[model samples]
Target: MAEVRDGYKITELGEIPLEWDVVQQGDISVFYNGRAYKQTEFKNSGTPIIRIQNLTGIKEPVYSDLILEEQKYANPGDLLYAWSATFGPYIWNGPRSIFHYHIWRIEINEKILDKLFYYYRLDFVSRELQGKKNGFSFVHITKSLMESHKIALPPLKEQQKIAEILSSVDTQIEQTEQLIEKTKELKKGLMQQLLTKGIGHTEFKQSELGEIPVTWGVASFEELGVFFKGKGIAKKDLSELGEPCILYGQLYTTYKEVIKEIVYRTDIKVKNPVIGYANDLLIPSSGETAIDIATSAALMVDCVLIGGDINLFRPNQSIDSRFVSFQLNSTRKEDLAKLAQGSSVYHLYAPSLSGFKILIAPLEEQQKIASILSTVDAEIASYEQEKAKYEELKKGLMQQLLTGKIRVKVDA
Candidate 1:
């Protein structure tokens, strides 16, 4: 390989300082495959089995009555690599859980390698490892293939320094995440209360939905706004620059609460472009789960073309669309789900949307409620931006520190 600098040489991974060594990852850390625990083995209480579902804290991982060999037990802060449908390196923070077959237990040879450093290194290249998985419907990472992967090894002190730097960023991210969760809880309460009880109201009245403020009126979604189903845009019709478009899938991924910017634009011919109007709320009409895709975002301008599986709700001037969207998030999701069709992917059709009832206030009152909630949304966005900036900084540091472009001091 050609020398990149006087003290640096290009290697298989990348350019590195001459002092550092490139070695097989297996040489530094030994990997053990987890036992494939089955449904029949599940018990009400025992050691919690870490499943792919539990990775996102979606569901509490179940327990197993059957005890496995010594190597299978995983503890808090142990490094684990999950490879199947979802792939990544995770510092196991849960209890002493029996891991599923999809996850691997990684043991560092402390004499040569630091656990945190290798975890961060594995995290840095997790996407690359994920790409190595073989399967069409599902991906699997074999122990043999992962053991042969290469790593750029640094001195123990430098490795610890890099890990410390990355760990500090992770600490900031964790704190920010907690703050985000708290802020969300606060916002949710505001949505539920403000949308129903309203601002500073002493009087209350009962209705089919629930008891709401006396001054507030109840209305079907049809009365407050008009609903439209979007057309399906074929893959052949997509391009970089064309008429600005909003896709159904994007409703779940992008565009939260209030959207001032649109991400996608389409070039291909559209039969009937269901252009977005001012104050039009867009949300997924169908998704894997009703609760997940139930969220909505309101547009502030006229945009052309809306993709299928998305339902558009254009509120009349009498109501604030963003306010109503927040209210839906707080209340109407379960109601909407009740009307959803299909089993696998629940769909919210026109009839269901029209029949849905909501507690409403006057236009000015609606605007005031929306403004108060928007302030909370802005605060959450600020925290998210800060967390993202810290993550970006860590990513830049990893690239430099791992490659040895920037040197870290090692104490004797």
Candidate 2:
């Protein structure tokens, strides 16, 4: 690694060129806090209210009757900082909305700094804070702590240059992600065609799952498999090691469609613990949402302990478990959702799921379909690696360019 350049000096914010200044965050921008908006104040049509959840995911802004001055509202492309319960910096890209109490609308003196540069720097700080968050699900990042941290400020021209260099890498990542999504879509289409019609088939047969090749057959969960329920263990009972166990939450969050490797285990011992069989389809019986309850994965290992709220299906007939696992997650997702019942805490009954329709192909054809999809997955994995490479490069450049350890030339 290159040592700090000759013109740079050591400072609280680390090495920077002599021309740059180390300034506290408070001195540069105002962290204007947002007001508390009441739930009853929500309306059908009014000024849109932006909550932390909306900024984080697919949530759309809710309309609010409460109105604030233009300065209090954030428009598209504004920098937003969330301090409590998921602290991070977000570049607001949606329509105008009122910022919630936990968020701040940062107002910077444009002449003294580059806004995009500050956004990236604060984001870097947030990531560092993640390790220090301890076991808390939510940790508040205080204004006092933020205001005390030092930031290295360069000339306005150089700040812009650094932002440009980093932003270019971000653009490349975005384009690669788009390609990955398109490839995944192509794979999905191929699955729908290949899994049903299959290759080199002439005769067709109509079933509950629509027309499939004559060689293909239709089977219910009960006809092809058996359902087994596991005993429940409290969250406190979980440990890093003892005996390998599968958790329902892990099914929703961690496991792949066809899970060949088990990562979680139970520290507690139970009398006659239910053991999962090889090639068993594992589904979470309880979840917060319908889509979550629809989550399923296949266990490739046998004799592993299964925890409560997990539904396991062990196929009796000769079949490819990987192909069935992919089928349930893709084509049968909607069918399972229709079987799911409830407003919250969506539930999937084992019996109801047992009767669910499943398309079956010859064992050889099933293996072929699984093999093709696996190849596409490998391609997506390669693109993910490319994305990671650019991201790591960007992180290194940010540490160097933001502090002027490596200086950027400004146009005359």
Candidate 3:
């Protein structure tokens, strides 16, 4: 007994505009599965085979000398869907290549539906299905099940308008992401130069670490700071509204070189909780890889709870915490990585870090270097925020326009 609006009607998908039609995915498009390849067929160079990893850009592309049917090859502008491992619609923007069996080359009936609009529709449907999966990390939709899925569609003109609007927002998001990456690259280059060469330094000297500015000196971490380990708290100890907390894993996944804010909290009452201090540097004590354990962030807020598997470094008055963080991430990353030990899970203990040495410039120069890097960090943060907003806007627009909740003007 759902109430329908004046110009809206109830369908299997709840309620949509009266003019919209609910149709099976197969009715409007043909999903051609890509060809499978044997390991022996793989070559060093040939036509690139698109796999689920390629869609996500997580793995290097594998090439094959084996030729496939024309329908198996996806060209630029063709809509593609990854059905296994990862799920989603991707309009192939890469060069014409053979797509793996796990992917589907969607051939839309453009006469009845716009390809880009259907692309967005497929994406929306995938999200909805994923939402209903109940905590599962991933769910694979069989070809028959995917084709049988029902979706509500608007008129061709309305579909085109919705696609155009969403595409514009996507473009904004992509451009902003590109800007963030470029700014980060600039920051990386700056750190490499400033941390080693020092600003306005012409003279250089060689130390156990490497060649550095003459004025700069190397100092063991133990001499610059006192180390302590966070104890007791675990991921299960976290809560939404409680004391702000920092977990060791967050150093690699959440915070940057400088922690401007805290995002997690815990309500669990622990006797004498390990509290963080301003200018205190934090690094993970354990991680999946040695390099990951080497990541560090300078805590700016005081009195926050420091969780277990973390190494907290309280710098002396002479040291710039931010400068030390940037140096650890750039110059001493490998040196610290070499010290990390374990079989499957890497561990970085205070004893290992006690004698770990790093470049130390004059206090003034350290602050100056930190300030320059901080400015770039701020720029990257702003761009990331902009990209997030654009992505959110796109989500809202898709929820409305794709469901006919919001209508756009169409040409007469």
Which of 2 and 3 is the better model by lDDT?
3
Question: Model 1, range 25-106, lDDT digits (tens) per residue?
Answer: 8877888788887689998998899888887566667898877897898999898988777777888888898888888999
lDDT of 3 by residue, 342-403 (tens): 98999999999999998899999999999999999999989999999999999999999999
Tell me the lDDT of model 1 at 237.
66
Task: Name the weakest run of 10 consecutive residues (lDDT summed) in model 2.
Answer: 129-138
Give the per-residue Cα lDDT of candidate 1 at 131: 52
Candidate 1 — worst ten consecutive residues by lDDT sum?
Answer: 129-138
User: How many clashes does each candidate structure show, in the order listed?
Assistant: 0, 0, 0
lDDT: which candidate is best?
3
Relative to the true structure, candidate 3 reaches a TM of 0.95
Candidate 2 C-alpha lDDT tens digits along 160-257: 88889999999999999998999989988987888778888989988878998988889888899789887766567778878878888888777867
lDDT for 326 in candidate 2 is 85
TM-score of each: 0.89, 0.78, 0.95
